[model samples]
Target: MLFDAGTWSLITDVLAAVFILAGAFLTFAAGIGALRFPSLLARMHAVTKPQVLGLILLLIGLSLRVRSWSAVAMLALVVAFQLLTAPVGAHLVSRAGFRTGKVDESELQPNQMEPDDDEHTA
Candidate 1:
């Protein structure tokens, strides 16, 4: 069997473990950041950014170990959906938080009481 029980060899197993552990560590750090960040926007950024990369790493590790096309396809879909939705979710959360006065407005620009009036100013 190519994978015997789970891994093809010690190297692959070790690599998978490394990737998974690193991903888990990043996720843990995100969790900590969510708790330690000063405000809602900071917390949303902490939860969304690293967590997406962490999820990618985790799915990669799982794909390496699982070695099945169907599983890989599903994981791919999960990654795709996450990439698509994470930013939207973060935006919604931060917008709602800002509207609810949970955001740190002092950190914003002097004229940023609302978003820039010029939509093309990016």
Candidate 2:
């Protein structure tokens, strides 16, 4: 009985710790990417992608440690809201960056953003 209960608790703690550490690592990577990347789009991608996933992982770890339904539910909502907005916010920021002429046009593909000549023709 002691082994079963105590071991299970220990396992849970270890797993939660792993998740937390991994989440921290992901967030750290995101920060590094945001700082190191040259282009606006690249920087935006770096800041958002891993950051969102890291937030999710961090929330998961918090939920596991709490082990409460209410806490988990709140965390789920947080994750949901983050997931819904992160991409959209990133999109807006990138678009703004592009429109502001901060992004290098040379970084884009040859045909990138080229209007469809056929579409405009009668």
The prediction achieving the highest TM-score against the true structure is 2
Model 1: residue 5 alpha-carbon error in angstroms: 12
Candidate 2 error regions (>4 Å): 1-3, 110-122
- Model 2 score (lDDT): 0.92
Q: What are the lDDT scores of the predictions, listed in order?
A: 0.87, 0.92
Give the range where candidate 2 is weakest over 10 consecutive residues by summed lDDT.
1-10
lDDT of 1 by residue, 11-119 (tens): 6768778889888988999999999998787899899989999999999898877878999999999999999999999999889989999877888768655576687
Count steric clashes of candidate 2. 0
The true-structure Cα RMSD of candidate 2 reads: 3.0
Candidate 2 residue-wise lDDT at 100 = 96
